[model samples]
Target: MTQLAIDVPENIFSTLRLPPAEFAREMRIAAAVQWYAEQRVSQEKAAEIAGQSRIEFIDELRRRRIPAIQLDLDELEAELNDG
Candidate 1:
């Protein structure tokens, strides 16, 4: 991956503190969380939007303390078998 360097004035940067790159990451995370909570988009779809893999998306959800598991009884059994 390639990275770009950005420059901002000290006062403006200090006021926000978060760098632009970090801010983008946080926004992506926040959007995923909100979409899950309110809009209830599927993990795969949300992950796609966030530019993450399914597992990574799930971990991101867990990091934010969201319950990332949603399975029916059949799905649970399937998961158990797969595990």
Candidate 2:
């Protein structure tokens, strides 16, 4: 596992009304959501990156009004056929 370090100015915390820890957590979730929304990563991987369970990540996606399903036409058809 690789660790990433971001240097944020202390004043930004005040502006966001969040503590450093909370802000870091929010950023992690945001990154996970963005990557997942873009289909750049799988939901499981995104959940791991966000430090959340699969269900929690899916809930978060719903909360953000982003579709949790990423299947395209071919994939959807295959899934429908298999079901």
Candidate 3:
């Protein structure tokens, strides 16, 4: 795995009231969420990037109200009509 180092302003942690490690963890999850939302990565990849299991990642998506399935209106209609 590749490691990245970044410089963050000192006041950020105090302002957010989060420890450095916790802040970094949240940033990773946020990045994964954005990439997944934009269709830039698969669910598996996003989960890996978020440092979470597939099920956990899916649960997080649900909690955030993001759709797990990416379907268009026509596809949704067809699925609904299938009995």
Candidate 4:
């Protein structure tokens, strides 16, 4: 378990329905996933950073319609060939 400090605007806080402590945890997970996406991190690694199991993270990615893999056409072709 980890602890963090956070503050939120009243309107946003109510809108998110976030309790103070849980808010920080959720925010950390959200930020971690976003940062990982911005940095182009691998799914497995991103899941770790988000503090969620890979299966859960992958499911969330699918639910969010975020691409699981960001591969160039050449890389995709090579991967397909290898497979």
- TM-score of model 4 vs. true structure: 0.71
**Best lDDT goes to which candidate?**
2
Model 3 clashing residue pairs (backbone): none
Arrange candidates by lDDT, highest first: which order?
A: 2, 3, 1, 4
Question: What is candidate 3's CA lDDT for residue 10?
Answer: 96
Count of clashes in candidate 3:
0
Task: Write out the backbone clash pairs for model 4.
Answer: none
Highest TM-score against the true fold, candidate: 2
- Candidate 2: residue 50 Cα off by (Å): 0.4
Which ranking of candidates, highest TM-score first? 2, 3, 4, 1
* Model 3 per-residue lDDT tens digits across residues 1-83: 99999999999999999999999999999899889999899999999999999999999899888888777799999999995
Clashes of 2: 0
Question: What is each predicted model's overall lDDT from 0 to 1?
Answer: 0.78, 0.95, 0.93, 0.74
* TM-score per candidate, chains pooled: 0.61, 0.88, 0.84, 0.71
Per-prediction CA RMSD (Å):
6.4, 1.4, 2.2, 2.5
Misplaced by over 4 Å in model 1 are: 1-16, 71-83
Two-way TM-score contest, 2 vs 4, winner: 2
Residue-level lDDT of model 4, residues 8-48, one tens digit each, is: 68677578887766676677567756766675677778788
Off by over 4 Å in 4: 1-7
lDDT of 1 by residue, 1-83 (tens): 56545665667645778876676676677887779766479888888767789999889889888878767789999999999
Worst 10 residues of 1 by lDDT: 1-10
Q: Which parts of model 2 are misplaced by more than 4 Å? A: none
For residues 1-83, write the lDDT of model 2, one tens digit per residue: 88889898879999999998899999999999999999999999999999999999999999999899999999999999999
